[model samples]
Target: MDLRIEQAGDRPAIAEVHRSGFGGEHGRTVADLVDALRRDDPGALSLVAVEKREVVGHIMFSRSLLDAPRRLVEVVSLSPLAVRPAWQGRGIGTALVREGLRRVGERGVPLVFLEGDPAYYSRLGFVAAGGEGFRKPSLRIPDVAFQVVRLPAAEPWMTGTFVYSQTFWDYDCVGLR
Candidate 1:
């Protein structure tokens, strides 16, 4: 498959991809997508993978804060990663994640967080953020679900409630307002 990944500007397409990937009652909407793209952090990256001009996968990241003891540090949050069912497990999702991390890393940002399976995210160098000073993205979810990665020269910083933007609330993230 000739797969190419790029920064996603097509919000409607991304919403469609997410709804298809999750197959849940809470479907994605253009409003949620617009809020995502327009967030304070807007993510370290928003990526879409295309095969033959059709988007088969989509991933978005945005800025959030890692409230540490002394200061608030910038954190890139990986969320709502989606891949069309037919294209999943074929490395499209992995490609998006690896590339997203690469792009974020190049920007000199030091921390990244996500609420997901450790087994999966650990494959991408993400580990429990608690040790380094960032809590799970929400209090309603199990703590184990959140993880973080700190880049070179940054200390394993803090552990507190992650302060994601209002966009996360609008998008129906696990459990907080």
Candidate 2:
């Protein structure tokens, strides 16, 4: 498998991968937020895994923050990961995520956060690492989905409600009441 993960440069392909991988609406979530960021704070890091010029899988990082001091940090939130059904389980998504985290860590981002299956991310060095926001805000699901991975060490007290990128306000996080 000649799988290579790198910065995503194609727009149409990105949309396609998002739609197919994540299924239904917001496949173009990053594109929308990217446009919004052009307004000033572009809050997002987009990555793509390509196989022979075809974007088989994709991932996106957008700005999210600690509810306490309002500090800005990128979060591994929108995992619009899609590798054609035929390619599922071939480690394409894993490659996309591992590379994405490495890049995020190398840039001194301090930490990476996500809402996903602990069974999956925990193996990647991420743990349930945060406090119960004064208000779990409606976006949080089952309390356990909020997870974090600190790189190069960060202030141990980094805790608070996490506000997803502005674009998040545009969608009703699935299953969130």
Candidate 3:
């Protein structure tokens, strides 16, 4: 398997990965969310996992804001990570995430946030953001689901509300309804 930055030609396969992973309407919604993020978020970082020249997994980190007491700080939100069903148990998703985090951190992003299962993300170095002085943008997101990972660039004073890009809100993907 090969891990690399996503290219234009990878979009269709990426969408398929999400659709296959999520299924039905939610799958399509997540797929569309990926397109919107790529189009609207200039700072978005996307990565793909390929095997046999086919995309098997994808992960994205899009620009978000942290309304810190001192000032608003730039951060990222990891969302819609998907691995092809056939590739699910092979660590493709983990590789995408590890690589995505490394690439985003290299860009000087202080923190990466996501709404996901605690059991899954905790293994990826994420912790409950609420307990660390960060607030979720919506109450719909459970406290346990709102997770965050701090990079070397993060500062002790950078704690605050994590705001997702408008596209997330526009697509109604911020949290569970």
Candidate 4:
């Protein structure tokens, strides 16, 4: 298995993987989120897992904010992590995430946040953001799933509300269209 930055030509396969990984209507919405981010978020970092020369998994990190009353801190948001159904359980998604976070850290990002399963993300160093004083930007996200992980150079006390990009709200919001 090889992991690398996603290229222009990898979009369709990445979308397919998202669709297959998540399934049904939710899958399509996730895939659409990927596309929207790619088109609208110039700062978004996308990575893919390739095996035998085929794209099988993908992950994205996009610019978000930590909206403290005193400051607006730039952070990255991880979303729509996908490994094809056939590729699940193979660590492809893990590889993509680890590598993606590494690259994001190298760029001087201090924090990363996501809304996901604690059981899964905690192993990856994510903890409940609420406990860390990072408030949820929207009431829509459940407290349990809202997580944050600090980068190598992060200030552990960098507390604030997570502000996701409009692209995230636009694509992921249900019943808002």
Candidate 5:
């Protein structure tokens, strides 16, 4: 499989991948979230995994913030990771995530946050973000699903209420606001 940055004209395939990977109404929501994010968050970093020239997986990281008392600290939020069902269990998702994080870190993003299964993201170095100095913006998010990974450039001021982009709420991200 090939892992690389998403290019123009990848929307249709990407949407299909997300829809199929997730399935049901939840899958449709995720696909719409991807579409909304692309239009609303210009700074988002998107990556795709391709096999035999067909897109099979996708991952996106978009600018978010830590709303600290004195200032807003810029961070990245990893969301909507998707791999075609037929392509699942073949490391396509892993390749997309590894490469996406690597690229975001290279861009000097100090923190990456996500709402996901601890067992799944922990393998990628994501840790619970609920301890002292960290906060989630809403009770909508499950305390356990909120995780964070501090990149090499993380700063002391990076702790605060994690705020995701409007796209997250607009898409109803599993009903978490």
Candidate 6:
């Protein structure tokens, strides 16, 4: 499998991965969120895994704000990671995440946040953001699911509320209803 930055041609396949991974209406919602992020967040980072020239997995990290006491800091939020059901157990999702993190960190992002299963993300170096002195943007997001991973650029003073980009709010995808 090949891992690389997502290209324009990859969008459709990426959407299919989300649809297959999430299924039903939730899958469509997540797929729509990916499209909106691509349109609105210029700084957003998106990656994909391709096997046999077909996209098998995708992950996205969008620009977010850390309302720190000292000053506003730029961060990222990982959302709606998806892998085609056929590729689910082959570590395609993990490869996309690891590559995404490495690339985002290279861009000097201090922290990466996401709302996901603790059991899944914990293995990927994420910890409860709330326990790490960060606050979630919404109460609807459970404490356990709001996770963060600090990169080398992170500072001790960078603790604060993580605010997702407006597209997230516009799509009403900030947290579970």
On lDDT, the leading prediction is 3
Residue-level lDDT tens digits of model 5 in 48-159:
9989999999999998888977788899899989999988998788788789889999999989988888888889888889964678867888988888998988887778
All predictions: root-mean-square deviation over Cα?
2.9, 3.6, 0.7, 2.1, 1.5, 0.8
Tens-digit lDDT track of model 3 for 33-128: 999999998668888998999999999999899999999999999997999898898988888889999999889999999999999889999999
Cα shift from native, residue 23, model 1 (Å):
1.7
Worst 10 residues of 6 by lDDT: 168-177
Q: What is the lDDT of residue 111 in candidate 2?
A: 66
lDDT tens readout by residue for model 6, 1-177: 899989999999999999899999989888999999998987799999999999999999999999999999999999879999988888888888899999999999999999999998899999999999999999999999999999999999999999999989987888897
Candidate 6 achieves a global lDDT of 0.93
Ranking by TM-score: 3, 6, 5, 4, 1, 2
Q: How many backbone clashes does candidate 4 have?
A: 0
* Candidate 1 TM-score to native: 0.83
Candidate 4 structure, TM-score to reference:
0.93
Better of 3 and 4 by lDDT: 3
Kindly list the per-residue Cα lDDT of model 2 for residues 38-75, writing each as its tens digit.
34344456677777777777666655665556564444
As for candidate 5, its clashing pairs are none
Q: Give each model a TM-score.
A: 0.83, 0.76, 0.98, 0.93, 0.94, 0.97
Best by TM-score: 3
Error of 6 at 170 (Å): 1.2
C-alpha lDDT of residue 18 in model 2: 58
Worst 10 residues of 4 by lDDT: 168-177
* Whole-model lDDT per candidate: 0.70, 0.60, 0.93, 0.86, 0.86, 0.93
